[model samples]
Target: MRAISMQEFGGPEVLRIADVPIPQPRGAHHLLNVSRAGVNYADVHVRGNTYLAPVTLPYIPGNEVVGTTPDGQRFVGLTPGGGYAEQALVHRRVAWPVPDDISDDQAVALALQGQSAWHLLFTAAGLRAGERVVIPAAAGGVGSLAVQLAKRAGATVIALASTEQKRHVARDLGADAVVDSTADDLTDRIREAARGPVQVALEMTGGKVLQATLAALAPRGRLVVYGYASGEAATVVTHALMEKSLTVSGFWLPHLYGDRGALPTSMEELFQAVRDGDLKPIVGKIYPLGEASVAHSRLAARDHIGKLALDVTR
Candidate 1:
């Protein structure tokens, strides 16, 4: 099997393709023939050694894969490691049969980002119909799905993107209004779009963006911090939250999937949405397995919208 292995923590250049022995199933894990792998910010963090959990050297970075068994049963799910390879050892419980209506590339998109969006809106935020919600980075994988899912749940969504092109993508995905986060009047624009204080904020990028979104929250509102893409720690003023009765919390996908770790019910709903054409996972770019380093560079550049994937078959 050929895999992209990171021998040291550094830039995308560290991801080198190497021929390695194919892994076999151990205990509850199953051998997976990797067809496609989702390239995410999480992978970038892992490669740079900046993730919340420390990463061991000389390890494969991917976590999500769409692939099959030797018998040709196709599945899409999370992998413990080796997802960027031609084959991987996947936990049996995390893998699920891919719906016939969905393509392998699309299924790859749902593996992590779809699950994160579902959990962010329903589990972490407890979003309600007719409420106002603000989502930052709304044209990216999780944000794009969040915009669509939030709209489906009857929430008025204010999407924040960095460019006009991305904002247009957000609007097409059903965001009620879209704002450029780079704008000087970002907070004001968001408030105007929502027509009042926002009830739920799906915050990913930290730093000044987090500070702005925190100030825009309504009384008794909920703020879910899922990612710090800006690479800056967001500081919260408890007194500010106390004055408005606002609440703040953080969400991590791994923590949400407890002991048994089976794919949750929300995944089923998300897949059904795709089958019914109510949801679409955008595949912005696809690179061959050997070009893993370039994929990482594009993701790190942050100019692309939607999901970036590795085509292992190529």
Candidate 2:
């Protein structure tokens, strides 16, 4: 098997294509012949050894993939080992068989981002119907799904994207309103779009964006912090939250990976949504497996929208 192996934690340059023994599945795990590997911001953090979980040296970085079995069954899943390879080991509990109508790219998009978006809103934030929700980074993989899912939950979605094109994508996904995070009046814009202070804010990028979104939350509102894509930490004051009785919670997908059985329901719901024409997975770009470093660079650069995937067979 061919994989992009990391011998040390550093930057994209550290990922190198190397030949390795094919992974063997045990117990509930299934061997996946990977077609597409989803590259995420977590992979970038993994390369830098800054992820929430510790990664051993000389490991592969990808967390999710869409692939087939020797029996020709197509599946999408989070790989227990690594997905930046021609093949990977997917725990059967986390693996969902791909529908005949869903392409590998679409299935791969649903693996991590789909699961993350679902958990962020329903599990972490406890989103309620008729609430006003704000989604930061609304054009990226998770954000795209977050926009659609938030709307489906009967929430008025105020999607924040960095560019107009991304904002357009958000609107097409059913966002009630879209705000450009880079706009000078982002806070006011979001509040105006929501028609009031938002009831739920899905904060991803840290720094100014998080601070602004926090300020835009309604009284007794909930803010679910998922990632710090801005590479800067956002400081929160306890007094500020206490004044408004606001709640802030952090969500990391790895925390739920231990409960393997917890994933199928959400995966099924996500797939069903896609199948029902209620959700669309935006696949921005596909790179060859050997260009894994390039894929990482593009993701880190924030040059692409939606999910960027690596075609292992290419």
Candidate 3:
């Protein structure tokens, strides 16, 4: 089996292609002939050794993938060991049978990033119907799904994207409004674009964006911080939250994956949503398996939109 191996934590250049032994399944874990590996921001963190969970050396970095079993059952799932390979292992409990109508790309997209979006909005943030929500990085993998999922939950979504092309992508995904993510008056723009007070916000990009989004929140507003793509720490004031009655919550998919019903239920719902045409997973650039470095580079640089994947079959 060929996989992307990393011996040290550093930049994207650290990832390289290598031939490795195929992992055999134990207990209920299934061995998948992986066709496509889902590339995510978490994978970038894993490669750089900055992930919340410690990563072991001589590691192959990939969290999700879509492939077939020995019986030809197509499934998409979270691979804790590694997913960037010709074959990978996923416990049966965490794997979901891919819908016949869903493509490998869409199935893989729903694996990690999709699961994160679902949990962040409905669980962590406690999103309710008819509320206003802000989704930053509106064109990226998780952001694109967040925009769609927020709208499907009957929330008015205000999407933020750094480029016009990305903003347009958000609009097409049913975002109620779109704003320039890099605008100087971003906080004001988000406030102006909303129908009323901004009630719920998803803040992944850190630094000034976090501060601006926090400032734009209404009294009693809820903000969920999931990632800091800007590679900067967020400054939050305790006194401000107390005075405004605001809530700041953090979400990491790894922790949620441990819960019994978390991944299975959400994966089923996400796949069903995609199959029903109510939700669309944007499959962005596809890189050859050996070019994992390129994939990491593009993701870290925020150069791609929607879900980027590695075609192991290539």
Candidate 4:
């Protein structure tokens, strides 16, 4: 099997191509002949050892795959890792059969990033209709989906993106308003866009961005912290949160994967949304499996939009 493996923790340079034996499924896992592998910020963190969970050396760094089993059942679902390979293993219970109308690459886009967007908005944030929500990195994979999903849920979405192009993308995805993410007046912009304090916020990048988003939230508003893509964790002031009556929570999809009911439910709704033409996935570049390093470089640079994927067949 051709796969990308990293032996050290550092930059994108650490990911290198290697010929390793195909992974075999055990227990509830099913082996898939990987067609495409979803690339995510989490993969970058794993490669650099900065993820919430630690990674061992000589690890394969992809957690989402879309492919077919030996039995010819096409599946698009979460893998425990090893997705940047010609063959990988996915838990049968967590994996779902691909819709006949969807492509492998498109299915790969929805598997992880799509689910992340779904859970981040509804499950973690407990989003409700008529609420005003701020989604940081609104042009990225999960953010883009969040924007569309939020709008579909009848929420007013204030999107923040770093560039004009990304801001335009967010607006096209049905955000009520879009702001320059790099603006020094981010908090002011968010509040103004929503016409006042926001009811909810999806925080991905930390550090200064976290402070700005927190400042934009209304009393009793909830904030979901999912990722620190900026490589800086937030230093929250407990007093400020207490005074504002704000709540902070964290969301990791794997935790819900254990909730058999949650996984199938989320996956079904996510797929149905796409099938009904109510949700559209944003897919960026698709790199060859051997060029996994290149994909990481693009993701780390934050110069790309939507989800990146590895075409294992290449």
Candidate 5:
């Protein structure tokens, strides 16, 4: 088996494709022949040693993947690490069958991002019909799905993206309003689009975007912070919460699956949505597993849109 390993965290150059033994499944765990592995911002954070969770040196990096078990059961789920390889072992209970309508690439991309978007809108934010929601980075993997899920929940979506092209993509994804965050006065544009403060905010970009998102929330509104893509984390202003009577919560999808006992139900709902054509991940780029370094470089450069995948078997 070939896997991407990093002896030390620093840059993309630290990733190397090397031969390694395939891992065996234990207990109820199943060994998957890795077909596609989703590359997330968290992967880059892990590779750069910026994530709060510590990583051991010479470790394989990947979180969510889509493949099959020894018996040929197609599934998607999270791995502790070590998914950037030819094969991965994961708990069978955590993995869900991929829908026939979804390709291997789409399944891998949705395993994490799609689930996160669903959980954030339905569970964490408690979004309801006719409410207005703002989704930052609406062109990215999770953001794209968030836009669709918000619409399905009957919420009017205000999508914030970095470029006009991405804004157009968000519109096509079902966002009622699209704002270019790269342009000056994003807060103003959001206000104009929504006609007032938004009821729910799906925030992934931190720092200035987080602050701006907080400022854009309606009274008693909720803002779910999922990632820090700005390369800088943001601090919440207590005054803002006090003034607007707003709620701010952080969403980590793995915690719900690992701790809240919601994996099975969540996966079921997401797969059903995909099968019904209500949800679909926007897969932007696919790279061979050996080109893990190149993939990381593209992510770091912010050149690609939506989810990037590693074709492990290729």
Candidate 6:
């Protein structure tokens, strides 16, 4: 099997495609003939050595994929390092069966992002119907799914993106309103467009955007911080929280799956939504397995509108 490996972490250039031996599934683990691999910000972080977990050197970097197990069962789940290869292994407990209607590319794109968005809205934030929610980076993988899920939950969604093209993508995904975060007065614009305080804010970009999101939340409203795309993490001012009685929470998908034991349920709901046409992943670009480095560069540049995937079987 061919895989992309990083002997050392630094930049996109470090990712090198090389032929490697296929891995075998051990007890309770299943081997997958990877069809498509999901590319995430976490992969970029791992490549740059900024991941929360220390990734050993000379390792593959993808965390999730959609593929068939040794028994010919189709599923999706975390693969840690070897997902960038043609074949990988995932834990049986973490893997969920993919619907027949969902394509391999869509399955790969949605597995992690869909699960994360569902947990963030339904589980972590406890978003209620008729609530107003704001999602930053609304055209990205998680944000796109967040828009669809929030709308399905009956919440009015405000999507924030950097480009008009991205805003259009968000609008097509069913966002109630779109805000261009690159504009000078982003918070004011969001408030003006929303007509009131946002009840829930799904913040991915940290730094100034996170601060603005906190300011825009309604009293006692929740702000869920999931990622720091600005290359720097944001710190909340505790005193400000007291004044508004605001709730600030951080959501990490792995932690949510590990702590609440809701991974299977979330995956089931997301895949069902996909099957029913209520939810769909926006696949931005597809790259062959050998061009994994280029995919990483595209993700790092923030050039794609939605999820990028590696077509391993192609």
Positional deviation of 197 in candidate 2, in angstroms? 0.3
Q: Candidate 1 residues 140-210, lDDT tens each?
A: 99999999889889999999999999999999999999998987777788899999889999898898899
Q: Kindly indicate the candidate among 3 and 5 with the higher TM-score.
A: 3
Worst 10 residues of 6 by lDDT: 252-261
**Model 3 stretches astray by more than 4 angstroms:** none
Pull out the clashing pairs in model 1: none
Between candidates 1 and 6, the lDDT winner: 1
Question: What are the Cα lDDT values of the candidates?
Answer: 0.88, 0.90, 0.90, 0.89, 0.85, 0.86
Top of the candidates by lDDT = 3
For residues 1-314, write the lDDT of model 5, one tens digit per residue: 99998888899999899998889658888788989998888899999898757888889999998888778888898887888998998787678788777788778867888888888998899999999999888888888988988898899999998888888899999999999876557777888999998999988778787887788888999999888887787888788898989999998876776654576777777777778888877888899998999899988777678899999987
Comparing 3 and 5 on lDDT, the stronger one: 3
* Weakest lDDT window of 10 consecutive positions for candidate 5: 254-263
Candidate 3 structure quality by residue, lDDT tens digits, 242-300: 98899999988878767898888888889778877878988899999988899989998
lDDT of 2 by residue, 28-116 (tens): 88788999999999999999988888889889878999888999999898864589999898887788899999989889888999999
Model 6 RMSD in angstroms: 1.3
Model 1, residue 281: distance off in Å is: 0.9
Q: For residues 1-314, could you state the per-residue lDDT of candidate 4 as single tens digits?
A: 88888889998898999988877568888888989999999998898787877778789989999988898999987976788888888888889999898878668878888888889989989999999999988889899988988988999999999999999999888989998988999899999989999999999899999999999999999999999888787888999999999999988988887787987888888888888777888878988888899998999899999889999999
Q: What are the runs in model 2 whose C-alpha is more than 4 Å off?
A: none
Error of 2 at 255 (Å): 1.8
